[model samples]
Target: MTVEVVIFVLMGLTALGGAITVVMARNPVYSGLGLLGTMLSLAVIYVSQLAHFVAAIQVIVYAGAVMTLFLFVIMMIGVDVAEDTAENLPRQRLVVGVLAAAVVGFAVYLGVSQGFDWVPAASGEPVAEATNGTVQAIGERLFSTWVLAFEATALLLTVAAAGAIALAYFRRRRAVRE
Candidate 1:
């Protein structure tokens, strides 16, 4: 097998293992750590595909900034507390297990039957220049074409921060009252 294939397989396994850990972990902090692993592995995969700009953004924005926010939220909400294992919905665990197994089986079958055949973009072409993962191209499109969507995401994040603060304040007030 080629080095690229080996690296791809390793990264894919790391990503999948991290996802499973995130789902199965009882500790919120561990789950966040697993998510960070998954994001970092994905960033590596992006880099392997020659998407340097995207890889940088993935590491900086998702793995660094987003994971920091997630970890902060988990710690703020008391990471020492264990999650309750009470099953609110009957047969939920069984159903979910079956579904998860089926999905895994399908993925395995696809991988074994049809191996990945990635097509690299033609370099030095006009289309490639426009679509290549470059900082200048991304900035141009983000600022000109997707500016509204970008602003909307910022507004959404602000609202979410305000809500978290409000919730924390109310909980603190109730605790003091009690």
Candidate 2:
């Protein structure tokens, strides 16, 4: 009926398609692309909700940087679809999928039953005159209380990057030797 409703519907479709693509696609790179599409749609949803800062961060961090990392890993690993058929279609995978589905369904039910009572944009009264999003508050908190955790995340990212490079290098070396 309304633009918001339409956007929400589109977002839902985007999420559904992305999830299906992730599970069904033979190519890891295509799966990553699907995830990127979902992330971009989620960013649009955040923007529609007036969460500009979160939308920007979602685009930059998830769609841009993290997707790049994912694509890099996928490319480096280079799993062959033909070789992965029977090995990947295990009972454990089915069980995990069922469990994940149950969890998501329960969460959705709980949210729909309880969360819709609350008014939109009325959750928390604005505390400050500043309309700036969570960035400033987050920066202040990080510098004061969460500096260690923030630095830890950076360190983790550095380690991951180094590991990726090492894996790629080793793969190339093995190829040359073979």
Candidate 3:
């Protein structure tokens, strides 16, 4: 086999294996590490596909920054916390199973019907294609063409942060009052 083929096969296997480890690992820290492995392998696969910029972003954003955040959350929550096996709502599992099956079925239907090619929705004028993977070109495209989407995403993230803060404050207030 060609070197590229061998790399793809190895990276693909690694990514799948790491995903399994992330799901099945008992420890949160181990799960975080598994996620890191998966992200790194995905970055390798991206590099193999000649998407060097995407590979760099995957490593820098997902493998580095995101994994660090995951590790911090795991540390704060504690890796040694005992599992609470009591179900709050008894039929929660059934509901979740139904939702999962529905989602999977819909995904399968979409895959079969439309195929998996990404069709970007350009509300305004169609976005000009970038010459290369330079940050300047990406920035130009994002600001000029995808400005509305960028603004919406920023607003959504800001609202989410505010909501989380509000929830935390209210929970703390209630605890203190009690």
Candidate 4:
């Protein structure tokens, strides 16, 4: 088999194993680690497919930030807590099942009506300049073509962080005063 095919198969299996571990792990930390493994494997697969930008984002965002958050929360909450098996809400499982079924049914209906064409295929026309998805090329494109959108996203993230900090500060102050 080709190297690409071998990489695809190995990463695919790693992702599957990580998903199984996430589901089957009894410890929250183990589950978080499993999710990290899955994210990293998916990133490798993206890189193998020549989706360098996507792979970078997958590793930077999901594997780095999100997984760090998951593990932090898991650590802060303590892992040895007793499980609460009591059903506080009546028929919560049934409600969830009904909602899941409805979502699936709606998806099936949409697929049937739209002929499963959610995203239209790309055009056959060859581009004047094809990018190899290198970091330099991506950076040039981002700064030259998508600078406004990039700055806007940065601004949005900053505002969101400030808002979260403000809310947490106020809540903590109130708790201290109480």
Candidate with top lDDT is 4
* Off by more than 4 A, model 1: 105-131, 136-178
- Give the alpha carbon lDDT tens digit for every residue of 1-178 in model 4: 8788899999999999999999889888899989999999999988875678889999999999999999899999999987686999999989999999999999999988998676766466636454567566889988999999988999899999999998889989999999
Tens digit of lDDT per residue, candidate 1, span 45-100? 88776677898999999999999999999989997777687888999989999999
* Ordering by TM-score: 4, 1, 2, 3
Candidate 2 structure quality by residue, lDDT tens digits, 1-178:
8798899999979978997898788788789989988899898898776666798899999999999999889878875635435665569878988999999999899889988665555545545544345566556777899889988999999999999998889989999999
State every prediction's TM-score relative to the real structure.
Answer: 0.64, 0.61, 0.56, 0.70
lDDT of 3 at 97: 96
For 62-154, candidate 3 gives per-residue lDDT tens digits of: 998999999999999988999886889989989999999999999999988886656654356424553355456667878999999988998
The Cα local distance difference test for each model comes to: 0.86, 0.83, 0.84, 0.88
Candidate 2, residue 95: lDDT: 93
Off by over 4 Å in 3: 86-178
* Candidate 2 global TM-score: 0.61
| Number of the predicted model whose TM-score against the real structure is largest | 4
Alpha-carbon deviation at 131 in model 1, angstroms: 7.1
What lDDT does candidate 4 reach at residue 49? 59
Count backbone clashes in candidate 4.
0
